[model samples]
Target chain A: MVLRVLRSMIGLLLFVQVSVASAVLDIEIIGAGEHQIPIAIVPFGGDDLLAKTINAVVMGDLQRSGLFRPVDLAGKAPHELSEVSYPDWQARGADALVIGSVALQANGRIEARFRLLDVVKQAELSGQAVSANGDQVRAVGHRVADLIYEKLTGDKGVFGTRIAYVNRQGKKFSLIVADSDGYNEQTVLAQNEPIMSPAWSPDGSHLAYVSFETGHAVVYVQSLYTNQRTVLADFHGSNSAPAWSPDGKQMAVVLTRDGSSQIYLVRPDGSGLRRITFSGVIDTEPNFSPDGQSLLFTSDRGGTAQIYSVPAGGGTEQRVTFGEGNNFSPRYSPDGKGFVYTHFINGKFYIAVQDIQNGQVEILTAGGWEKKPSFAPNGKLILFASEARGRGILATVSSDGRVQQHMFTQSGDAREPVWGPHL
Target chain B: MKKLVICVLLVNLLAACASEKPKEVAAAAPETPAAKETVAAEPAAVAVDPLNDPANILAKRSVYFPFDVSAVQDADKPIVLAHGKYLNEHPSRKIRVEGNCDERGSNEYNLALGQRRAESVKKMLVLGGAKASQIETVSYGEEKPKATGHDEASWSQNRRSDIKY
Candidate 1:
């Protein structure tokens, strides 16, 4: 009874978190990168409100990454290189500084010019002008942050990328696509049925997902541009786990029509169907390798659910995970060196990654209701589903297992989160 | 709605008991008018459909299973068999078996497991003389739950297959 009362209290708290304008997510970050770069971002010079909005986005992105530490401005605001006092930043212990200015162009486009400087060297590292429409202030900010991140870390930034997940509230379900920071949520589909396993196409133009609108599990491919959807797989039994190939020409889907759940490949236009895995058992959740030559899937043919790999052209299957616990939802890294999956052990679900060569497994999150892990396009972070305070939320852990973040939606339980490809 | 039905059934049972007491009290009186009324109501009482009768096994539609196991256990065999026999006798009624799972595994894995569970019950129904054409199976996986708790008490109830007509 006390637990029930506590859950109701949490429900009330979550209800109050909902805003009137849009469905905003509350993000809580934990841990930090090994080496933190102390950087300072000064507000842009022109368009005060727009500049503040963009600066907030850039600052939030950099801080949430767990890599950069925000250096206190202390009333020091410089919007251009000529106005910056190098010795002032140096004295403030800032290794790097970012200064920018925003202006509304006559063509109604907003342009922001940013510069990243090295305090120690007393030299400019990189400078670029990013422009977007007035309404896309966040996009402009993300672009600026990405440029700064790439300049400093030598790794691609995922600030401009998108993610898709299912938001379930009672009997209502919605397939939502949102910005990487959990902003700008757009509902692709909403209905009074369950939706699961949303897989983004390699090009990010479409999403293939499983829906129960037809009274059973069926796969559908819907284009984000036109909002047109077609049945990709509507077999007699359950059709689910639609995974797109790297080339975007075909997809692998799990179907139970031919007997037990088996993996099958078919074209995106719902033609050229070919059965792939002959495992007459529960062989599902097929994910394509980066090279598109193999598929990593979960199967129970070995008496327990484990990660297995089979050639894309249909060949001998090899077990990829072993010992201790059952693993599910195996997704290959962009580098194709290892794979991340859900590791279930002792009645707990953990997000774990296994190396293909050494067979070494690294547990990322401190085990909870974490499941269906997929890597970011840059292979720097892994996103998955997690439960907090009796609600399902989206969570991510860095590849090194050092940084972690939890994103709570405004309402409903978020599940089946998949990071979109690099745009 | 189910509780309403049970309440109505209980009231009718009590009224029948109250009416029967008067008949039993006058057992020594031969050819009583109350005995004639009882004889008249016997056929109507026997005419209730077994599927609608709470006392019959056919009224029970759900078959429960252990975690990760799809086979119909001995405890639920009679329920499945009773439905199977009823279908075979009627030859017109059809049922859809929906399988569900506890929130333990990945959604996709649980989906396949639930499908296997539904198919297992369908196979048993077919073996018990129900035609394959009379049965259709689907899996809701861990999406729908009969219980909302996270403990074994709830998980046990969630891992089940319901026969819906």
Candidate 2:
């Protein structure tokens, strides 16, 4: 099954590269749950280009979520709610049906309407209409998917969100932002130096990262809109590992100017520098808790690298992880109930999540060189960097580890993925 | 003819004795070759800077460390000491110690670890009579790896502190 899926993924990747002007990430579902929601998405009735593109985008979003298995409609689509045949969808093993239509208005605007139906009950669940310009048809489709996903799952959808990651090809490194489904990739910053530790601000307007452009590690915060950036930390020694506070007013960074690697809190403009952790050993990778009262970091004060927590203002450090192998890059879940990190054991690295209240560790991935796990805004999925086919690839796993998907780029290695907040 | 031969032999003997005396003088003043060469007739050898001399221990710039370790090992002490001595002798010369780590753990933690490694070497250089101001330390973490392979052999080669003058 895995081989067959991989072969299809490769074939689709080649087709996408040759046929499409705007390239997209190729997703390969690694594992699936025993039961998947079967849904049928009827092609939106329109001969225009925008309609077909929106239809494909909606289906792709649902299929990538791993929660719904889209059944092939075999060119049979309903243009409106009255045309949808509930019995036909049910016969094709579709528990739910989606019917939509897109039309170009006389004012040069695109209006899209979709309806969700229960095949068994033969009842309409919900319906909504969204209008946008021709350029925003993709985003309109994502919004439609979001509505459908929430109606069925009782949770907010992440299809409309974005993710930021680093892509390295030869001597060039670029920071790219793409849709949650790995489409519409845009390189925000491209340089000849190495970029690491990309952290999105609370408002998702800026990204603070470490760059080695000046022959040393310096932290910089770049604005996604203005295309302007400011040097956050450029101390004498090494300034790296920039993590934003939950409120977006302050940032936690690792600096070695004073002495060993210690955590320091600095404003976004690089002022009001105050040391937070006073550990004699290495203290780095500071991440603010969801409540913004404590900081989770990795330290080797106990002779081995482990996750630890200290008061955001400064206090005694407490070790939080006691599992075998080393744990690093701890990121709090959206709700702050748990945190995810990269765990190394038996010569293999895995992504794991630990409950904050009970300290119970649950390994989410089997075994791969996985690192830098960042939770989605809803906290239902975790995006991380893993090695596949001897190259780095971005992957996502359901928080419970039931479903897995790999997002591979055609060129270069993709790593250090940080899921953006809901816009 | 015999008198001429005897006179020539005496002159040759005197030249040999003169050469033997300079050899004894060169041995007596072993540490001051420049001064001894000035007094001799042969052209003086060019002075080679010890720092640039491959035969000198100061030429060894990289001080390797064990995996995830920052402490300076005993085997690498000689190289550090040679650099320390050179820095002390030439107080005007400034050196920067770059700390690096293998690609294993988190980049931030490795940055901290690399800083520790660089600082440890800087501390040792200071303790060995080099001025604190003459040396600067920077940790490149795993960003500037000397080896790209993901193995013990490559990793060991990458975990090091290089002294740049």
Q: Which DockQ values do the candidates obtain, in the order shown?
A: 0.67, 0.54
- Misplaced by over 4 Å in model 1 are A1-21, B1-46
lDDT of 1 by residue, A232-287 (tens): 99988799999999999989999988989999999999999999989889999999
Cand. 2: chain B TM-score: 0.72
Per-residue lDDT tens digits for candidate 2, residues A249-350, read 999999888888889999999999999988878899999999999999999999989999999998988999995799999999999999999898777889
Instruction: Give per-residue CA lDDT, model 2, range B87-121, as digits (tens).
Output: 77689999999999997887778888888888989
TM-score of the B chain in each candidate versus the native B chain: 0.72, 0.72
lDDT of 1 at B73: 86
Top TM-score prediction, candidate number? 1
Tell me the spans in candidate 2 whose CA falls farther than 4 Å from its real position.
A1-22, A103-110, A131-133, B1-46
Candidate maximizing lDDT = 1
| Ten-residue stretch with the least lDDT total in model 1 chain B | B24-33
